[model samples]
Target: MKPTGTLPLRAGLGLKPEHYQNALDAAEKAAGGGLWFEVHPENYMIDGGPRLAWLDAIAERYPLSLHGVGLSLGGPEKPDEAHLARLKKLVDRYNPASVSEHVAWSRLGSTYFADLLPPPPTRQTLQTLGDHIARTQDYLGRQILVENPALYLSLQGDISMVQLYVEAAQMAGAGLLFDLNNIYVCAHNVGGSTQDWLEAVPADQVGEIHLAGYTAQDREGDEVLIDSHGAPISGAVWALYESFITDAGPKPTLIERDENIPPFDELMKEAGQANTIMDSVARDRQYG
Candidate 1:
């Protein structure tokens, strides 16, 4: 199997169309050298258009990463052939430094859901997920990173959710795109310790890390953490990120914001914060 693409150990933001010009401008400035950008491949799976043109221009400036949300990698059926074809085209064209998808599935039969639905964690599901991830990697001719899904409810399984995630990636010779925010949300929504996820996942196998924000809602009398990528990174999640980075060193980290979009500079600021932690880690390693 082809090796997964490599990304600079730097911070990236989820590219938004509104920030295209800013991104291009930043790329030219010395300040943007450490910045990279990731996009949902589903947005650029097109023939030709102004959007594709913008992406082309951006690709020329900074290293790119494709974070896909529609692969349904954990779904029952095989990945859609047509989607893979379109994705492969973009992969070949841009040669993104990384390509990743969530462990959740969003499709069933001919119907599709707009949300990243969590899959049950059973041995059968593990086998299915491993097969799906392997097939996805084989078809794309490149290894891909599979992210853990955000959980809202607990389900019975022979193995723990974290185990399923890490083992499946190992089984398929793929990497893990550990989303720290998701784990934080899971700990609140279901019931577990984020440390369990941090310890369960092998740091060397982590190709990338995602740091996003979640919202809390008062459902009935209790509060729940929602993986709503619409707020600033919380102090708790930031602490979690720092703890992990201190031990694991740095990986290609991303600041993801998909709703209530903020100014480009604001997103860049968050990226800078992540860069700071990574920078600290780099400094420690150098001195030690």
Candidate 2:
């Protein structure tokens, strides 16, 4: 993808309190030309608190990525107005270099599920998602990126993944936050090739790349990969990521670990692996 205005960011970590000081220290240290941090805006969706304080501190030193997990842009209903306003406040205060949300819908009627749920890819769903994204952008007064959700079950859907996502990006004037781990998980679960998905997606619309861990479950003796960002990235996923880096070129790659919280040093190490790979890819691109 050809990054238009913003200069591409390198590797970064999803911010956790355990690693906040480490992120601040890394921002100051510039070890390997520094690292960036992405955060779940929902965690900081408070009126006033230490979370904002920490965000301000780290954001001052490094480029921050505000990735939202709960926008529910693909719901059968319109996007929540209050949520949009709160998200806009965060965007205005931080002026984050990048902002993103998932493609999955989480809320049905008034009930909200904490986890992202799959949406049937119909034309109606795409229209709703596009409108929600556009409204979010209008409220935030800027462009946003839409992340591909990890799949669990194979559902009968009308539109293809790439087609719906590409159309949504185009209609909403948004970018794609490509998650390699999710692509692998979905492909493995739903019986498709990751390469085909990548090739079909409009590469220029991709703004960020995510690398996370997945768990393999033997569901009735059939292996299914779950997008559990709890542990270190797997070898196969990393190999696929490397292949994408070589072909698609580099973007702002992020190491995501949302569960099984670990020590600061360990999390930093996970982020460091992604950093090393992105840097190597950049150098290869430059020299080759």
RMSD of each: 1.0, 2.4
The best candidate by lDDT is 1
lDDT of 1 by residue, 193-283 (tens): 9999999989999999998999889989778888999999999999999999999999999999988889999999999899999999989
**Model 2 lDDT per residue over 1-288, tens place:** 212225246777888888777777775767636567889999999988888898899888888889998889988878888888889899889888888898988887888898888888788888988998888888788888998878887777798776777788789889998898998999998867888777877767788888999888997999988898987888878888787777777778888898887776776777677667777888998998
Name the 10 consecutive residues with the lowest summed lDDT in model 2. 1-10
- The TM-score that candidate 2 achieves is 0.93
Model 1, runs deviating above 4 Å: none
